[model samples]
Target: MSDLAYSIVTRDLSLWYGEFQALRSVSFKARNGLITALIGPSGCGKTTLLRCFNRVNERYGNVTTTGEIRLLGKNIYDEDVSLIELRKSVGMVFQRPNPLPLTVYENIVFGLHIHSPARLNASALDEAVEQALTDVGLWMDLKDKQKSKATSLSLDQQQKLCIARLLPLKPEIILMDEPCSALDVEATRQVEELMLELAGRYTIIIVTHNMAQAKRVSHECAFMLMGELIEHSRTEDLFIRPLDKRTAEYIEGRFG
Candidate 1:
């Protein structure tokens, strides 16, 4: 419905887990190469909407969806779409860093190993690792520690590695669900900086309850209430002058 070109577009999309509906006719757009933050109280379906972009919710079982979710204008539910490819194109970063037990180098190239049409040579894999880490501003910090286990890294490093891992697959969109929630203030600031740096190259849709974070990191913000989208606007507008009373109330801390 937005006039802007969107990397993700949900058209009257709805979802349910058995009898409990989680999303109700939610329609929105996330513009290409921009950061869009989804903000809402707990159970308001922000995470659900983020997962819908990559169709990850179906893995939970007993879930059903209606309406359309288009990635770059192609309906994701189309019969021709490959789930593996879809996932590769739309990567995710969770609330807490959950790096694989493998070495840092291996973790960064894990997706490449899985998605490459042909097995990449050691040099190619190494290059991929370096580039991915460099993209995330981790090359200098982790280059010497590539042999170390990824889990052994600090929380911020692990989270950055999780994001780096997706790079080898060349994802067009990155879905981050509270990616900084587990880190301290300093680490949160660093990750926020990384998100800003990565925005022009990747469309980012982040779900966060931290209002300040949403304002600081996102170009656009969407507010949700009880699974319904209440307002969506530029970050400055939404914060300075919310169009919806509900949005104003939430932003003003009247109630979540």
Candidate 2:
């Protein structure tokens, strides 16, 4: 479904922290408006690969990277690329729920105030906040409590707020790295449900060690092992008829 208008493409992208190569010149296509899951055991470099999409890896020093990461047909590594704008379009949600200790409204408006200042007037900001929260199924939960301190909310709600904050910017893609790892079962389920609901609206790339979660949310999946992409296919095919012996073994619970 992604020949033309590819949302994100990595061409022989490789990264290394000093001498330790983390990604092995991996190349792949992440289609627009679909949920693509990255599944692998610990230390397999799935997380590292996901970070390259948003240039998050660039924040770390001594991290040398080689190759092109293209977003919406533009090479993101281009000298003139605006990291700030690029990041606004490619948002990220980390493993822990790190909502700032401010009012719920502040949590959502924080980025809007900084990223979309020209469009963040009173009425527009309110509308954007409402839409973002609504997208994550948290508007009703947080509407009345928008004035409440963000940290005072339950862990589940806090996580949702973190996600809601990302939406106001209208990002083209979302990178979630084990986003529900800290949540309880119910909260985790809610996040998973939201992801399933979000497919085809936002390009989502999530890295997870949870096989069930991967199967539950992904339309397609890429399996990785020790810094190499082992297989990429439809979720059903990957789980039901894995081509790689390692992928099959992992899915069958041979090892992580």
Q: Name the lDDT of candidate 1.
A: 0.93
Clashes of each: 0, 0
In candidate 1, where is summed lDDT lowest over 10 consecutive residues? 1-10
TM-scores of the candidates in the order shown:
0.97, 0.95
Q: What is the C-alpha RMSD of each candidate to the true structure, in Å?
A: 2.1, 1.8
Scored by lDDT, the top model is 1
lDDT of each: 0.93, 0.87
Residue 69 displacement in candidate 2 (angstroms): 1.2
Model 2, residue 255: C-alpha shift (Å):
1.4
Can you write out model 1's per-residue Cα lDDT over 6-53, one digit (the tens) per residue?
899898999998999999999998898999999989999999999999
lDDT of 2 by residue, 5-59 (tens): 5688888888898899999888878877889999989988998988888888888
Candidate 1 TM-score over all chains jointly: 0.97
